[model samples]
Target: MIAESLIQRKPPTKESAVLRDQLLRDLQGAASVSEPVARQLLERLTPHERWALLKYAGKGLRDWLLAAYRDAELSAAPGLEAAHYPELPEFLLDRLQDWEAKNRRRLEARIKNGHARAPETLRRMMVEPIALARFIADRGVDRWETMKMSDRIAFARTRPKFAQHKLKAFITFIEGGNPFQTRRGRPPKKAKKVIKEIRQIAVLTPDELKARLQDARQRLPADQYLIYWLVAKLGLTAKVAYGLTLDKITINAKGRVVIRPAEAWFAMPKSIAPTMEKLARNADAQWPYETPTDAAAIPVFAAVISERRVGPEIFRSETTLLRSSAIHAAMHYGQLDRKTLASISGVSLKTISDMEFLVPADIHSLVSHDLVAKRNRAILGSDDE
Candidate 1:
């Protein structure tokens, strides 16, 4: 049997109770708390009370309180320790470990979800110079230390799965003291070969690309016309076209179709919007079918076909079948040698030059410079500003 303590326990002090209540209120209203107010509150708290507050409060809320205090110190003086919470060291280390474990689990889930390349990306990050790796690793440490948590919770929030893997890798390196060495000097500059290749793809155009869409439309469904329109006319990357909805397309009073592109609508990176608009115009001219009545309706692509209208089992498939088919049709019509067709169709020139397939000239002719430029500036980039 355990013996009772000889010393009697003391009741809570009125000051401590008031402090606790104020701390809770501060945490709850942290978003609106000014730095000066946060610093003043911190100044009033004893070290023990500060530690107790951090230990008891939610991690996110605690981090916000500390951050406000830190910001206050920065605005006043460089070395002011007004925001310093010594108790943070031990608490932060424990929290960092917890974050790392959570991140590892998320990475595993992503790998299971077909993000098989994620591990390779992590490995590449691990191989970077110590300074760069340490910088990223420090972000994870600081994020956890201040309770401003998350694997990618700093400047930009990463996808949960990716964030978990990246955070775990970062924490591991920090704990291990980063075995990778910093590079000795500036790395050699490699020739901008890919940049030139991209420019070539951008400028490439077929002398005449016609009849390719008509022939492909014969074999494909009417709804699939949008895919052809995107690939041939708008200069959209195939991935962007997959996310297109009827809402993004509008028919002006002039009878021409206008496509408003959005970043969320396309799964690709935001930088690709310019290229995508150029591709959209090319697609619009080649597409034979009229726009649908319902603006909210999503376009049906051959890749995502299923028995049910919407189901748990529906999955994305081919992104560029229409473009490939168009290329094949162009080759068959004896217009295969034209470099301009590759630019206009948004297919690589090498694909056309190497492949024996024929695409019609009529399809290529639809990609007018006037239309391409209009779509590029108006739909993809800023036309108004």
Candidate 2:
């Protein structure tokens, strides 16, 4: 159930009410019952309506819409108030707001100059500073200037190195001209070696890889299975697959399914070509009012089970596991080199290189080279030689 406080909030204005009604009517023009309403559907809904729709929607719609909402929120300005953290002192809150406001102005200046940046960027910049500020306040430290290097180090130890690095901007802001720098450098070579060892051990054998693919195909729904197939076979990341558009997928003259994400084109596996073709047809047919070639006019994968629109956020947890398993399988089989793996999977070459240790050093083919040559000779006839 939606919270009573949420449901009890002020009702929509007459103008917005009419807009919502019109939007609901326009949604009926979509070509298929399974297709989502236009992208504006969630944007048109009031916050209360959005909450109700999310709660009542099927898994597919909720997943898609939630991701949309999050993206929208991140791009919008964030509210700054002690209400967000009631325990923080007024002075601490002021300091935090001051820091946030300074960054906000810089972002606004960039926007004014035509370099558009989402407030999410500012939010990211402020998050660690606010967290560190709160940490200092909680320890009864009233002034940031009074804090020592030891205090900063104490906080750094609790966060990942990347997050800890974010404090540099805050330190510069606080110290005016002389920013405090941490003594820490890149993680030691020993730590890097340990991580590489872990990746090597995570490699999957051929039989185990086959079992995983078979199990997923048998158990997952058509829409989800398609996602898994894309990741496992073509090495496309789940996010890339999820955002695939009708314009990005096509059938080449050779009767093969081709997918273009960004500028790169990859042909789909023959085993799954027919399914992809059908999905493309369905998606195109679903948007009768618009041309399928129109960028993002039709999402390649969408809700199949219900009218309620879902978001990609639903599959957040599983994407990593699917991606990791695919990488491990590829490494073990040694079918694709580091450069090829990076190109197809959108994984960094650095990461692919680091995981190269997973490939077996002494992998041997089942058939000897001479036996393979003899079989080829038998097939082709000695006369050809």
Q: Which candidate leads the pack in TM-score? A: 2
227: Cα error in model 2, Å:
2.2
Q: Pick the candidate with the highest lDDT.
A: 2
Q: Candidate 2's residue-wise lDDT over 244-265, tens digit each? A: 6666777666767777654355
Query: Which runs in model 1 stand beyond 4 Å of their true positions?
Result: 1-212, 253-255, 262-385
lDDT of 1 at 361: 40
Candidate 2 CA-lDDT value: 0.57
TM-score of each: 0.27, 0.53
